[model samples]
Target: MATASTIFSDCSSSTTARLVPLSRIRNGILQFRQSVSVGWKPKNPSLNFISTHGRSSSSIVTVAMATEPSATVIDGKSVAKKIRDEIRSEISRMKDATGIVPGLAVILVGDRKDSATYVRNKKRACEAVGITSYEVHLPENSTEEEVLNSISGFNDDPSVHGILVQLPLPPHMNEETILNEVSIKKDVDGFHPLNIGRLAMRGREPLFVPCTPKGCIELLHRYGIEIKGKRAVVIGRSNIVGMPAALLLQREDATITIVHSRTKHPEEITSQADIIISAVGQPNMVRGSWIKPGAVIIDVGINPIEDAQSPRGYRLVGDVCYEEACKVASAITPVPGGVGPMTIAMLLSNTLVSAKRAHNFE
Candidate 1:
């Protein structure tokens, strides 16, 4: 019978450390509980994941030891604040110089709580940056033609420089048709087929990039992460975040591979990536073992899971397991505070850009 140390020695050596499931070492031998202090900053010189278990339920127990986690936390919330300030300053200067202020129009249908909250937030963000926001809220039973009419109205309004159609529209509505109605120049959400097509081309540029994916790349750039010549993996293929993220990464000259539900041996593929952007809406799907040591991780998923301890009966989590990835990756983004804020900030950015182009403002 091999000891737990002997069994896992082959998995990692004394010089190298890797996280493994404690239950896998010996089926009936050990039971351990791991806990880390909430809001514990990772600036300490040592990798710290505290274990507090008085008694072992199994015959033998082994702990996963690791060196100091040096991963830089990609602070999206702070970066977003900086971006908003910059946008605010630019808007003031533009307004002063040309007496022109950027304006964003949003057409929202249905009454989904999440969608309503998102629309409200966008309106608030627009107001914060001195951008005028116009909204049309329709009942859930509204027809596609009605939504299209609103978009058409915005398209012709010179005062409205950016147009966004809140997503997850009623199932009966034709998303493609509705998205296409917004003039390409004012399509700030960047979901139009023409915008996506332009983004995919080498020599062409879309008037606006999707907010969430654009924010992911922006976070990387602000952090001084080099994307050129890197091996990148996008862990989803949805048109919104994953696909656009891959295209954006490609535009930055990084070699790209997409892993979807059908991909075999995801861990093996992910381990080789220098940069990984996960947008698969699965809670804690990517573990420590799936990460490459020193790789940069941009987690775009915001999945809610039931949590009895919470007042809301649920809590938000990202696709990448934050605790596990923090130990292995060189840098990572936290959910809620990570890609979430950036999305709205980028939306504001797109609106400002559209306003600048529309007014021929420098």
Candidate 2:
């Protein structure tokens, strides 16, 4: 086993020499201890650093390059698979012990193709994790009351441990009212005002966290990225993604700045962040220059743009310019394979968590 000092000393980085704290070393110890306890050997014992350069906080481009080779690409898809497998094993154990299988209920209102696809994927993910999935589909003309009634029914259903209402509900329906109608205990999507409020306030535990943001942080943790006291910039402020992402990042002690469409000089602000998470839904909106050289880039955008060579007639893209970002950023996530799959994995994990809490399985 590699000692914490050995892990940090192997990297010839002067910035890391100063910034690496005993607390971070202690965290590495905890992670190693958890791996040992779980009967899993550490895959890569060397510490991975998310580097930032050309920033006012530190002048350390040399260290950034020295540490770049030591950093590993955070494989969210693989990590999500491991998480799902763990959940499946746990679910199997619970079923054998208590004769109960966790169930998740998803509500989809309207006929949007993308929404339908997301719902199908969620159902498939639930099944893969041994969780039963129940879905309700409604027409575009459905009233807000109808949606609320469906949620109320799920809330009362003893078998349904988690409830998720597909987003982009018809313009006529009140999204907030429909979402709030789902009992907080079953609010697996974690969009309820109560959950969001708890997440924003310190020392309050949320019943569940929104899936996408939770996955982002999970990537950081699994890959050993240091978030405490680092500058993090979230580009975009959608209630579903960007806003929640910023809040979650802040919880990890990262000084967070939100860059929205209306914000002037978005790049200028983003360029200063040690960690950059972009969820703006615009293809290649965040240029390479916007990133501080060697910063960790988490691209959350899933935009489909024209591509004649493909059979699908288009290709998926992220908010960051991938080709340029890969060269400038120390580490960057690829579109489609990055944040998309992790979102569903987190949903299943949260459902399992809800079931365990409801049944006292843990």
All models: lDDT? 0.77, 0.72
For 22-109, candidate 2 gives per-residue lDDT tens digits of: 1121100111111111111212222222222212223243454455332235567788898899999999999999888999999998
CA deviation > 4 Å runs, candidate 1: 1-66
Q: What TM-score would you give candidate 2 relative to the actual structure?
A: 0.79
Judged by whole-model lDDT over C-alpha atoms, candidate 1 comes out at 0.77
**Where is the poorest 10-residue window by lDDT in model 2?**
27-36
Error of 2 at 63 (Å): 24
Candidate closest to the true structure, highest TM-score: 1
TM-score of each: 0.83, 0.79
